[model samples]
Each structure stands twice: as C-alpha cells, then as structure tokens.
Target: MNGNQKTEPTINRKTARELELIQFKSGYEDGTIIAQQQHMNSVLGAISFAFFLALFSAGPDAFSKPALIVSEISFSASLVSNILLFFFYKTVSGKKDLEYIWDFEQTSYAEIFKTIALFAPIIGTFSLIFHYSTLAFIFSAFIAVVGFATFLLAKNQISLRDSLLSEYRLSLLYAGRDEDYFTLKKHEFKQKPSAEELKINKYDYSICNQKKELIGVVTLHHQAVVGDIIEIADSEPLTVLRIIHNERATKLICKEYTEDTSAID
Candidate 1:
C-alpha cells in the first residue's frame, strides 16, 4: 500500500452525471441567447419596414404640423432602437473573446434598445389614434407582436449573461496556476492487481493501481489519501480508474472497481 487509507473518495457516478448536466444547462442557455438575438434581428427588420410603410401610407394630409412632429419623434426613436439592435446583433454574431463578451454584457446601452423595442407598439398605437386610420388596430397589433418578440430576446440575453458570468468565475479558479501540476506523459500498468493508492497534491492527483486504464474525468469536493475511498454526498463509492494532469487543472479519471484484476489480456 502507498499509505494508510483514512477517508473515502468524494466523487462518484451520480455527482459526475450532475456535473455533466450543469455543463449542458449552461450550453443550452448560451444557444438560446444566440438564437433569440438572431430572431430579434429578423423581427426588427420587418418592424422597420412596416414603420416606414405606415408613415408613407399616411400620405401628405397625414402630416399636419402637429402630426408631422409626432411621427418624426416616434420614428426617430424607433430608428435609434433599430440601430442599437443592429450593433447588438453584430456583437453576438461575430467571434468574440471572453473579455469582449464580458464588456458587451456590462454596457447599459443595450437595455435602451430593449426598452424602446418593448414600447414601440405603444408609440405606433398613439400615432394611429392621431391619424384616425381604418387599419389603426391592425398596425398597432403588428407592432405589439414585434415588441413582445424583443422582450423575449432581452430575457434570454439576461439568462445568457448570468450563465457566462458563472462560467467566468469557474475559469478564474485555474486561470493563474501555472507551476502547481505536472502532466503525466506515460502510464504504467501492472501484470496483476495491487492495492489502491491515491496521492493528492494541491491541484494534481496521482492514483496507484496495477490494473488501471485511462477513463473519463471526475470532480471531487473533499480530499482523500492513498488507500482511503470516499463517496460524494449520497453517491456511490468512487474508484479511481486513472489520473490526467494538464496545465489548467488535474482531473481524476474514475470508475467503479471492486475486484482485483489482471493486466490487459
């Protein structure tokens, strides 16, 4: 034995599965944000076209001095909102590093577009009321649909922002550690099974097992020693299958192993 076994391993099958699920959830949120941003671009395009169509359809009589001022103000606001949406789409569509993404999320200007987009229908309805047009309700309803779409886009972006922030915090845990862990270039296997032993450093782990092979990565919250086997909270026993060391961090590759085994046949 490498050392006296004291405690059990903390990572097991169930906790590994939960970590995988968390990664999937974060990925889904990111995809939803991108899809919604694209959809907003298309929706805003249609809304812009309709805005101009309604303004022109009103004809010369539609713009008395007072009416003209109201239309100009509302249309200008809508135009500015469209410009903001365009920039937002550009940022999301282009390839961005983590810093750029963080910066974009921090800006308050994007919220202005969201607010304008959400309230556009109200402005359109007001304009129609002044014109006394026959299709006033229809135009107002169309703008309302666009506004609601914008609302959904904004909500998804908020979710994505939160998830990215969470991911960034996780990344920081390994961002600056450069000399703590060393990578294993080769692994040795024994002709027959031997006692299990695990060596844990600050960020790296070395598992000693005669009949062992490379397996997938696992996470743990607590520490363990050579002969000690630990279990995650309410999970099965964690049997260390292998170990992987990289510059970013050390991963314990594990699987359940209860019986002694010979080397590869």
Candidate 2:
C-alpha cells in the first residue's frame, strides 16, 4: 500500500477562544532549563553558519593581502554579534525568564539579536563588491544593533519581572465568536461584574469577575454549550466584559466592536 493508505480521524480546528486558552495555560507552565539552553545553542550555530555563507560569497579576491583587513573586520563583527547572542541566552538561562521569552507581549532577546546578526552577511558581501571594501562598517552596525537589542530585552524583561512582583497588572483577555463577549473590549478600576446572563438564545448564560487583578481568566462553569453568551469582567480592564454567544459571529468582535464603548474601558 502507498503511504497515504492509512486513514486518520478527523480533527476539528481550534476556535479562537480555545487557542487563547491554550496559550494562557502554556504561559503558566515553565520550560525546563535544558530546553532553554538548547534554544540558545540552535540560534548561535545558525548565525555562525550564515556568516560563513557570507564570507564564501565575498569573492576569491577576499584572500588577497589588501582585502585581508576588511574581511577580518567583517568576521570580527559577526563574532561579536554571536558572542552577544550567547550572553543573551546565558542571561535568560540563569535568570529564568521563560515566561517573558515566550510571551506574546515580548519578543525573545535571541530572536531580535540573532536577526540583527543575521544581516552581517549582507555587510560582508557588499564590502567584497566595492573596490574600497570596508567590511568594518557593516559588521560594526550588526554588532551594535544586536548588542543593543540584547541589552534592551534583558533590561525590559528584568523590569517587567520586578514590576509584576511589586504589583498585579490586572489584565484580562477574551476571544471567541463575539466582540462583545470573547474579544477583550474594556476594563475598569473597580472589579464590577455580577452574575449577568447575556441571552442570545433563551438560555440564561452567566458571567462573573474572572481576574483578581494580576491576570483574570474565566471558564464555562459547565462545558460550554454551542449557544452560550458568557460575559467576563476583570478589575484592571475595569468595565468591559466579553459576551460570547455563537460561532457564526466571532469576527464581528475583532476590531470594530472593540472600538465601540458600550462596555467599560
């Protein structure tokens, strides 16, 4: 039989709400130290590989004595960038900011720096093309950008941790089929949400305060039925509550409904 002969069970696509919930849950869990280190090594190796490719493209004349200085300069800059990335990974590894590394709100230090480094090949290639090749400038720029991004990522992540530890952020997120219910609409200072039923169908679905300030979340008291209009509230998001009801209308909640101020902002 052909490889395609095997049959597989059908799988339903994840709803926005389901995907959001999965992300939320994953954030709460932490990755092992080994996994974090492996991530760093992978990035460093990739950057080094790209640099080699750049050097190869810089032409045979690169080996000539006059061009030696420029080639070395490019290599040095790429080296610095890689070194900085290594430190960034090490910093994260030691500090254990797995949450921030994987956070939607934050970009990984490795990614930003590695990206900055990834541009090094362009600089080297250009240097080789020009008669007065100065690979120094390009490599220097790469090093500077990646270095700065690494510093900023580290600083921001540390600052975020300190701030969160000091006080709760009081945030809420909702996403499903309705802008009113699933997509986060608004928030207020006072955590004010009582058991209210947003009746889309005749069913008296309920909503309550989900977040305790730091990060409020909500769930169906029972397995969410197909037509339940659940309202959610968070103290920081102050007044807006997500009103989820049905599947056919999830997109309505993405941007336009978020602009309306019917819920608290």
Any runs in candidate 1 off by more than 4 Å, and if so which?
Answer: 1-35, 65-73, 91-98, 101-114, 133-210, 214-243, 247-265
Candidate 2 structure quality by residue, lDDT tens digits, 1-265? 6887955433367766777777665633434433544565456546556655566564765566455446446655665776655565556643356565556224576567666565664555455544353466567667879999999999999999867643432322222335543222344235533343222113233333333222334443343443334344622222324445564321111111123476766
- Say which candidate scores most in lDDT: 1
Model 1 TM-score relative to the real fold: 0.39
Give lDDT: candidate 2, residue 153: 100
lDDT of 1 at 64: 66
lDDT of each: 0.55, 0.49
Model 1, 27: alpha-carbon shift in Å? 9.8
- Lowest summed-lDDT stretch of 10 residues in model 2? 249-258
Question: Taking the candidates one at a time, how many backbone clashes does each contain?
Answer: 6, 16
lDDT of candidate model 2 versus the reference? 0.49
